[model samples]
Target: MDVIVIETPQLGDRSYLVHDGAVALVIDPQRDTDRVDAAAREAGVVITHVAETHLHNDYVTGGYDLARAHGAKYLVNAADPVKFDREPVTDGQVIQIGNFSVTVVATPGHTHTHLSYIASDGTTEAVFSGGSLLFGSVGRTDLVAASDTVGLTHDQYASARRLVHEAEHDAELFPTHGFGSFCSSGPATGAGSSTMGEQLTANHALTDADEEHFVRDLIANLTAYPSYYAHMAPANAQGPGPANLQVPESLDAAELTRRLADGEWVVDLRNRVAFSSNHLQGAVSFEYGNGSNFTTYLGWVLPWSDKLTLVGEHADVEDAIRDLSRIGIDSPDAAIGTEPHAVAPDAPVASYPRVGWEGLLEGRAADDVLLDTRRTDEYAASHLLGAVNVPLHEILSRTDEIPAGKVWVHCGSGYRAGVAASLLQRTGRDVVHVDANFDEAATAGVSMAELTV
Candidate 1:
């Protein structure tokens, strides 16, 4: 059997293509199908099945569209309340593809309808434990609802133990959530694919722990997930459209001005440094960088109904659109790659002052504001004494709450602080970007506080 892992680093999710010469199966695919198709073509096999472990809460699944396009059977949990037609699967149900077999194992925790698929040839075996039985930790159980947290945590423990007990002793485990994903309950202990044997000894949920302790730890560790998560479940339930790679038309200065005046979203997709140096007055920064979670921030801040205009290079704009489409944002109204001067020669340009951590400490004054753009839990763990906790995702909505003056923004690292500074500056607030390591706050003699829950 040949197994190919397709990773979407930004979403921290993986899709697998498993085949045995003639037929293949795709598990937990993202909205972009080009890679999957390419993989299938390279393998010289026809895709006969596409399966989703659950209704994804993080990004839109391309399973349905891929299945329809390839005329393959689309599989989902039988219990999920999906609006589209699918081959509903139950526990222990096995589907034969060429010389391989995929058996469904009901593992509900990440969601009520979650399933883990075990694929095996006559010899070796592997399990695609989507969101269950992760490398070291398990999937976050609180995404469904606050009240269901405890119950889901209990289910998570049971499900993880089941994978360890029922699957083959040496079954290679591949999970969809981990590697810096917000959907993970905690950080994974190891890297790459792990076996059930390794997990039974190392995975937190698989270790000998009581249900209460596991639930408590799971709930306590969940950081702030993206606000765009609210739109994913419903959209996935109804089945989102196929991926659209078409770039929007380039808007000239006149058209861009009209959109800005009409309150449309003007997102600058350049690097934070370029965006900070000079950008259109109203455009906000959603930098296209390796460290930037482009979709998460853009989806969190942009209203569902607002028309978006991407401003960046052609390649960058296309890449941004492709990433945005993963979360069910198929296309923007317009995109422009022209030089800033040529596109908006007469328009006003704005910038925010970027300062290092040392500068912030040396120039500290009583009247200045220090903003912490990390998650609430991170802020509570350890933060500068006087820093106000306003996560970068919520900065656009909480502009009125910020005190008037020079706001100094910093996150765990500098990436988020740059994004926050741009938003603050765009809103006409005097802002200073504290682009430095937050760990140095204590060394700089800044007062620190740790909140106890």
Candidate 2:
């Protein structure tokens, strides 16, 4: 049996296709089943089964649709509160597909009903640890609820321990999260490939013998996740239809301007530099140029019910729609063109100055408010002296707290600052995007401090 990995880097998750040359089983597919179907075809295997480890809190799953399309048996946990029909599998139940034998293991924590599948074909074994035991960290326990966090963290610890004891130490590890997904409890080891043995040595879930210590550190370090996460599980439980990848109706400059005026999320998909140079007066900067984070940030900050319009090069606009669809934001309207003014002729033009830490040092007056848009933990670690900290994720809710001044916002790598600056700029604040890497700011002798708490 050969295991093919289908990585959704945009969402920092991976789905697996295990096949015995003729038949295959797909695990935890994203909303776009086309990619899974293409993989099966490319491998010359018929999809005999599709399984979901849990009702995902991240991307909407394509498992149900993919199963229906291929006439494959869909496997979901019997305990999941899902409305869709599937071959409900329970812990310890074994299923056969072509040359592979899959044994389901109850590993709850990512969610209460989560399951990890161990697939073996004679000599080789592979564990499909969907958001459970990731590379060096486990999936975050907070997605369920604030009240459930403690219980779930304990469950997560136990689950990781169970996997290490049950699965072979040499079993190849393939987790669906921890590669930059917010679902991760913390930073992963960043290794490309790992085995259960490696996780046993390096994963905190395994190395920390004291479960209480593990839980405390994990909970305290838990940072703010995307606001859009609230809508995903419900959508998955109801079983969303196939993703709508079809391009939305193209709007002329006048219609686009009207949409912007009406307070729709008209996102600009140029680089932050280009967007800082000039943009549609009301358009939000969400640059789609290599925007692996396009869906994450855009989905996080935009009001969930707001109609979205993408403005960029034709290809970039199309790609942004595809990324948005994975997160269940479907069929957003499009305005294709490179230049903001060119795309929407009647739209007012806007520009903001972007600079490095040195430029900030030279020009910043005593009255200028330096805004640190990194996370709270990041601010605690090290930040510009006297900079106001409103983490990028909390920027929407805490906007009123930031003092009125010339806001010079900066983040670890300037991405979050770019997004924050645009939101502030849209609110009629005098803003400057600090487009420099924070690592450089240190060597450049910028004043920095760490929060005492």
Candidate 3:
């Protein structure tokens, strides 16, 4: 069997194209389906089946659209309350695709109705575990709801162990979430695909401890996930439409001002430095180049119903739109490519002061608040002395907690810090972005503290 792995690097999810010469099956596809289609065409095989492991909570699935386009059977769990038409397959159901046989294994925990597909073409075998059994860790069980976390954690452990025990020892294991994905309960020890044997030996969920201990550790380790995740389940349930990849029209200066005046979101997609150096008044700086978490923050802070406009170069705007679509932000109302100065000539441009780690330590005062925008676990592991932890995801709601005075913002690298600084500046708070390696704090002779509890 030819197994093609398609990865969405930004979200750290993988989709699989498994085929046996004549026909193929796509598992857990992302919003953009063109790449999968292209792969199928190149392989000279028709996409006969599309299967979803679960109702995704991180990004929109392209399974519905891809299946409709190819006239393929869209397979989903019968337990999922999805609105669209699909073939609801249950546990032990075997689907024959040309010379390949795919057996659906019910694996809950990632989602209550999650399924892992085992495909074999007589010679070789592979399992598309989706979010169930990852490279070295299991999928996080907390995304569903707080009440379900403990129960789901138990299910997750059982599911991981079951996959390892049931699947052939040498069978290739391909999971949807792992490689730096926040969807994982913990960090994967290795990268890319791993054999069932390797996972049985290395995966923490499979080998770490008993169910109770695994659940406890899993719950404790699940850091804050993206706020965008809240909308994904509902959107996926209703079957999100195909993404509109077309570049939006460029909004003139007057139109941009009108939108901003109406309280519409105008996200600036430039680098943090450029965005902070000079940007149109009222434009929120959500630096596109910051990191893969660009869409996560945007989806979290901005209302989904708001008429959104993106300001950046052609390339950046296009890339942002694609990334945004993964989280169901399909199309922006407009994209502005005109120079900011020309677009809003008379408007006052806003900028924030940037400082190195040493500079922040030396210049910080009693009233200055140090805001750490990293993940809660990252903050718990180690952080600067007296730095208040308000992760970038929680910044919007906790702005009231920020004391009056300059806010010195810093994250692991400098990306999140830059984004936080712009957000603070937008709120009229005097902010200093510590645009330096946070690891340099100790080396720079700054006081650092590690949380004991």
Candidate 4:
């Protein structure tokens, strides 16, 4: 069997093309199906089967289109059947295509109707375990509400535990999401593939944690599933239809800065904590990880804009750039109808409106609420006095906890404060950010206490 894993880093998603003889199977495909079609053509193989482990919450799934285009049978979990044309895959069932065979095992922890496809090339076995289990953690159970929620029932979790036991100790496991992906809470790193044996022993959530504990930890750590999933999932399940989907253009740094100065949004796609610390003063933050599904999220949540800039982790810029391309969001040379804004050659970090103590005091005097959006531990160690604690990650769901008024957002530095400002601004709240810490204000002889909100 020839197995190729297609990594869609934008959505932190993975799809596989497995073939034997002249038959091929594509599992959990993302929105873009051009590559799969091309691969099949190059190999002179017919795509006979298109499989989806489950209806995803994090990104759109492309199983339906692959099936429709090639006259292949669409495969999904037998339990949660889609209305569209698809063949139901049952637990302990095996799909045979010439010499290739894949076993469908019901692994219901991540979602009630989820399944894990175990591919066997006559001898060796590899399991595409979807969101059931990941490298260091498991899929979150709280993404669904009542009827669709999975892994909460005792029977459901036990079934997951059983799936782990059923797989061979040496079977290669491929998960839907790992580190750095919005699916897991731990800092996304070193979260490569691992064997069932490795995960059973080294997986933090699996080892030294009970099934209930695992479920609780998964729920507790999940930041927030994308709000776009409510619609994107159905669209994907039915198939995204075509590749002609249009996405907006992205602005370069200078153009983005100019738009920000002109009262346009500069949505940063970095992590929550990093976004809070230092960002452009008037920027808004969505913090969608480097993935294609974020495209739909951006479309669903944000109003159509002529200009936008994507700020990502320095290391993630390329992947982030690629993901944005999947949805047709092109990077433009400049913002339309505006000149690029350039910072001075010798400008200090404190020179930005969101960076230093001087701006912090002025922002406070503007009757803006001083918000310290950092982790509780980070807030405890040291922070600007009189700044209320409101971590950026919790700002969305905990919006009511924040006092209503003009807001001044800040963090240990200025990144997270930018995120807070962006989120707050998106919700129609006026906000400003300081350039630096309180010490910078004190050094500049600014009275932070006197500038009361």
> Each prediction's TM-score against the native?
0.96, 0.97, 0.96, 0.68
Alpha-carbon lDDT, every model: 0.85, 0.89, 0.84, 0.62
Best candidate per TM-score, number? Answer: 2
Model 1, span 45-118: residue lDDT tens: 99999999889999999999999999999999989999999999999999988899999999989988899999
Model 4 Cα lDDT, one tens digit per residue, 1-453: 877778776566678888885899888887668877877788788899998888876665566777888889988876674667679889999888767788888877666777888888767778787877677666666555644443443434565466678788788878766644555543223466788787777665556347666555555455545454555445545555554333334345555555656766555565544544554555555555533245544644444334455554443444444454444344522222111122211211111234466555544664457788877655565655567887766776777777778777777655556556767765667666653554465577654444323
lDDT, model 3: 0.84
lDDT of 3 at 373: 90
Model 2: per-residue lDDT, tens digit, 363-393?
8889999999988877888888888999887
Task: Return the candidate ranking by TM-score, descending.
Answer: 2, 1, 3, 4
Which window of ten consecutive residues has the lowest lDDT sum in model 2? Answer: 283-292
Q: Please list the residue runs of candidate 2 whose C-alpha ends up more than 4 Å from where it truly belongs after superposition.
A: 450-453
User: Which stretches in model 3 have alpha-carbon errors above 4 Å?
Assistant: 261-263
Model 4 — TM-score against the truth? 0.68
RMSD of each: 1.6, 1.3, 1.7, 7.8
Better of 1 and 2 by lDDT: 2
Q: Flag the better candidate by lDDT, 3 or 4.
A: 3
Candidate 1: stretches off by over 4 Å: 444-447, 450-453
